[model samples]
Target: MRNDRTIKWLILLIPTLTIGLWEYIRHAFLLPYLSMELGNLLAPFIVLAVTLTLVRSLFARLEQSQQALQREKGTNAALEERERLARELHDGISQSLFLLAVKLDVLDEMKIDGPVKELATGLRETVRVMHEDVRQAIANLRLPPSPAAAAWVVPLRELLGETAEMSEAQADFSWSIPDVSLSDKEKVELHACLREALINVRKHANATKVLVVGEADGFGGFRCAVEDDGKGFSGDPLQSPGRFGLRMVRDRATAMGWNFLAERRGDWTIVELRKQGGAAS
Candidate 1:
């Protein structure tokens, strides 16, 4: 509405200003014999030009404002969803998982058959893993979609450390992140892909040690690698059954415009992800 009023005023003033300027030039600067014909002929064209310029400027500003509003709307929606997810995980899954783990621990203490006791122990271990996963989910939800590298580094290392301990494997984590910006989607996919890789190690790789490395490209990109000393794939991991998790990771990397590679180098199985178009720091 404001823009419309400004445009309307501009349109009304264009002719008035053009006519006045013409009359001033004709009467104040010219001889008495000067013809008003030229002034009359050019005044409308001058008015039209001025009107077009003003209209274009107004529309440009309007378009810019519209774009800014849309961006703000998107940001708000994303934040609201993040908060909702955080609350649900904390109040629902996290609490339930914690209670379940406690119950399993109590079951383990009961006097039962050897096999039943073993089963209870196993169940408790599984519950512990599930509880950790729930806690990680809650953490992710609590953090902003695009958080500082430092904010994620400690949590990621702890997650890997826990997974290694569960699998009875040694874990080494190295991170050298430069101050580069990553979009929320990119960060989420990156973390998911790395988690999947580590999961593969924990499930299949009879490895004793795992190495995880991460580094930012310093120009708005980053890379991650998870390497394990395990019995590597013979041919193609992607073609094997029960490898759907890695396939999902590959798809996510592709969607995010990141390079993904999983292969065996000698005795080590390596999975790597690098953001496209990002130069090394």
Candidate 2:
């Protein structure tokens, strides 16, 4: 920022100072041999030379700084994204591994009269779930970083498309979002939330068509929704057995400092995520 300010000052002051000095010289000294008319005629050329020599150089330097800043920002964002993905992988595997160990310990400590078959079945299920989690994490790791060169919503479009195919639902998606509305971290969280919402729609909502829409809120904020025309299921996360996915999404929203809404609006089941203006993005 300091460099930026200095460059701007140079851009403005170089021309103004040059013209002022030239005028003073033209009147006070050049007026004798360099006539008033000749000095007047040469003023434009002097200014042009100063602009080309000093101001133009400053402008190029300023542009280079801007490009450097952009590159730095992209690098930082990429690092942050990698860190977040690593955390996701670690957390998922650690929790499942810990649970698996606990189950194993219980089985090992069981008595002859214990429910050994039941415990075995539970252990098998846990292992299956852990396997799936590992597979998913590996797949996520293989995905390239968010394409900065393309629209950020490109991945979301593919996700929704897959949801549509898997659920046999016609999905309609649209967005009108300005750039910088979501930071990379916020985008990851939003993607997870939307993925969870779509999973709920596919597994629970018996809908024929789904609408996913995102838009700038006209206040430097953004909102997106996944709405399905199906039998919307609703319950308190604490009391609902099938609402675990929504619970996970809601937890993620809270973590991201965003708003989460899941409700039945008339005939549509709506799952919406929103973040207000002045967010880190």
Candidate 3:
């Protein structure tokens, strides 16, 4: 504020001072050599030019600073929204999903039969998959806004490590890219997709070892691969049991113009997410 007042004063004073000095010089010194008529006509124009030179630079700098401050405020607002969203998801959807899963578990164990039993079983699996989806959603909401690739990838790595440990699976994590050039939206989707993949490996893949890889896709994009040496299943990604997470990941990838593929390579089941034409926003 003080700086603003000073700038305002400077802006007002520059023209006044320029005109005053010009008048004084014309009367005191240049009047005798130059004609009075010429001085009168040129004084205001000279003052205007001088004041413009002085004010232009200041205005330019002020404009730049204002733009920078606006950008910072925008970033802060986005982060705050993320934090609020995370809290709401955890407190509302996550808890609700947990409760639903518990109810489904009870239903699964009940002495029911016929179509109802099969429906209950299917619902149980669906709730389990949805529970994992809610977890990944919560994680994504809680993730910090990362400007650098390293910062963004660290959370994903930690998530995989934690999931692997919980599943008692040995994880070999490798990241060849120091940073990724992806938009914030892309980063969140990528992280969520990777987390879901790892969760699938943890819960369903009865695998003893998992190899997680993150690297450039060699086409101006990035790729995340989660390969598990588990008992591979055969079926369509969308129609298989315990495969809802894969479907969600695939849908997000498709919506974002990325690529998602799940296949058995040799003895390992590999899930790969690729983002082509990666660029930061």
Candidate 4:
């Protein structure tokens, strides 16, 4: 409405100014000019052109603003939907799969053999993978407003002791930080990597001993190492065809902006990770 009023005022002013100038020129020079009928006919066309240009410009600006607002609303809606799906997967599907895996494991232990036992074990492993995938999805959906860091002293002695019992191997775990705090995200990623490393050791490492170590470096970073007496590989990691486990470790490390190294030295293979900044402690 304001734009329309301004255009109307401009259109009226232009004809008024033109007529005043024509009259001044006619009186001062004593010259004949076009008849008033011709001037009257051109005035309406001039006013129409001016009004159309102004209205077109105003509408263009309005259209641009509307488009920008719509784009912003669409982006916000996508983020909210992603968050909602992540929450549901974490709270509902993950718990259900975990419980199902537990039940299958119990059934497998009751002298089951052949296809049924194999199927049960496979189902349990499948559920475990799904659970991990859901957790990773949730982690990826998180936004940049990070949670506050807190310190917790992970009881390395107790934790490692339990892990050793479960692995049924001679566990040689060491740590320098008796008390250290890590961000929740970092802690989750680190734990997942550790679990994968241990599983690899148990499944492929044909040795009687495994060593796990965690330490804080002086340069505001942390390092972890998992070494096993396994049959080490000789080829390049990227060129290897049956190295999915190593690929997963490398991918997780890359996602967290950490450095990962896996190499063989004689009969032992070592997987080392270095996180570049202090997480919480």
Candidate 5:
């Protein structure tokens, strides 16, 4: 309504000012010629020029204002999305995980058969995965992109150590992440890839050790390798339903625009990732 009023005023002023200017010009300069018909003809061109200039200026300002408004709208939308995801994580998955934890604690106290215990353990792990997914979603929504120099080695090492201690199988783990930090996106993607690899080892590997190596690329990117000493598959991972872990890693790498490879080496399975460019700081 305010804009409409301003436009209306501008429209009214254009003709008023044009007529006033023409009368002044006629009295001031064209009075020597003293021809009313000549002033009438020139009057229209003056009014046209003035009107065009004012309209152009008004449109330019309106375009700038619109662009600014659009940018603000986008920012608000992003913030609202973050808040919604956070609320979902707290209300839904957090409560579910807490309930699962209580059930697992109860199972630990019960005198159950080996098969029943194993099934309980599997259910617990599934619930844990759901918890991790919710936490990741919340982090992605709430946290700003990590700086390029953010170090991921310490956290990765700690996570690997904790996983090894928690798993029942005899396992050995090694890593060589550089002393530098990774961006938030890189950290998230790398964690997802590593988690999938570890899950595969726990479920299907039937062997002992996992090795991880990471290094910084000269072009501000990074490369990582995850190798497991297990009974390796003989078929193409892309075509095998049993090779879901490899497919998941590949999909994650592809989504992040990174290079991914999974192949069997002798009796071992190797998965590699190469990020092409630095993520946002």
Candidate 6:
């Protein structure tokens, strides 16, 4: 922006200054040695020389510098977005495959006749669900970035609905956040964290129902979560086989100075993201 302004100002000022200085010098002191007709011809050539050697070159260098800066910015943005997608893949798709593999290995080890057919059918369903997830992720990643997008609740609601549809689970989202509660980037980041949580629920939770809730208070603090009535493990979910996605969600929240937790609350497995402090709601 600064460079653009400088270029504009120079484009207007340089020509006028050059012409004025040349005319003044020619008329003021050269009148004795030079005739009016000769001075007139030399005046144009002098201005042309200054323009070609100085103004043109200066503008060319400035434009080249500007172009370089733009290219650098574009490269940085692309790299950042690529990293974001890589994280998503590691957390979502990779973790899903890991769980699928674990389940299959367990099923293979079991020689029971009755449950073998059931386990095989379940594994097939899991594969089909994963295929749907990958397709949905590709469609989402292809969308252009939009900072001035709709309110946070819109996409989150749609995502929860999709998760429910794919998993054949009951899903509901309750949002109490006003439009002013979160900035654009905050909304985007929180949405992504919640997405990973939902993916975990869909792939590994074996949930029959899902509930997502988001709310903000007057103190600029907010809370959000993806909760499911899924099977509970004996230890911390962070130490479980599907920990990769949860850890990614935790890292994202921590980087934003927010709190994240993946744990079982009674019979409910809740993955929560929160920020406890800021300006008055």
Which residue pairs show collisions in model 3? none
Candidate 6 structure quality by residue, lDDT tens digits, 1-281? 78777876886688789879877887899889899899888877887888788788778978888898997798679667966895787678867776786777777677766767786877767676666666666656555444453544566788888778867889988888766768867877888898888888777777879999888866788889999998845687777775798889988888888888877889898888888868321
Model 1: number of clashes? 0
After superposition, the stretches of candidate 2 with alpha carbons farther than 4 Å from their true spots are 1-137, 146-150, 255-257, 276-281
Which ranges in model 1 have alpha carbons more than 4 Å from their true place? Answer: 1-37, 51-55, 147-188, 199-224, 230-244, 250-261, 273-281
lDDT of each: 0.77, 0.77, 0.79, 0.67, 0.72, 0.78
| Tens-place lDDT digits, model 4, residues 113-184 | 899888888787767756765675576555522333322223233444444665666788676632344555
lDDT of 2 by residue, 1-281 (tens): 89999999888788788889999987888777897788888988999998988888888999999999998898788777866776777777757776786777777666644577676767766566456545555566556565574355676677677768867889898888765656668777777788778767766677889888888878778898999998876564335774787888888988877888888778988888888876644
**Residue 110 in candidate 6, Cα distance off native in Å:** 18
List model 3 lDDT by residue over 59-83, tens digit each: 7766777788798999889889988
Best by TM-score: 3
lDDT tens readout by residue for model 5, 27-135: 9988888688888888888888887888667766666767888877877886888888798888887887988889898997899978999988888877776677567
lDDT of 4: 0.67
Candidate 5 lDDT: 0.72
Off by over 4 Å in 5: 1-16, 51-54, 144-234, 238-281
Better of 3 and 6 by TM-score: 3
- The residue ranges of model 4 lying beyond 4 angstroms of the native Cα positions read 1-168, 178-181, 237-239, 276-281
lDDT for each residue of candidate 1 in 1-281, tens digit (9 for 90 to 100):
57656766765676687779877887898637676787667778877786678756766776777788898889889888988988898889889878887787778667787888888877776667667676777777776654445565565677778778877889999887553465555656767888878777776787888999988766666778999988878778899986897899899888777788999888789999987455422
Q: Model 2, poorest ten-residue lDDT window?
A: 129-138
TM-score of 2: 0.56
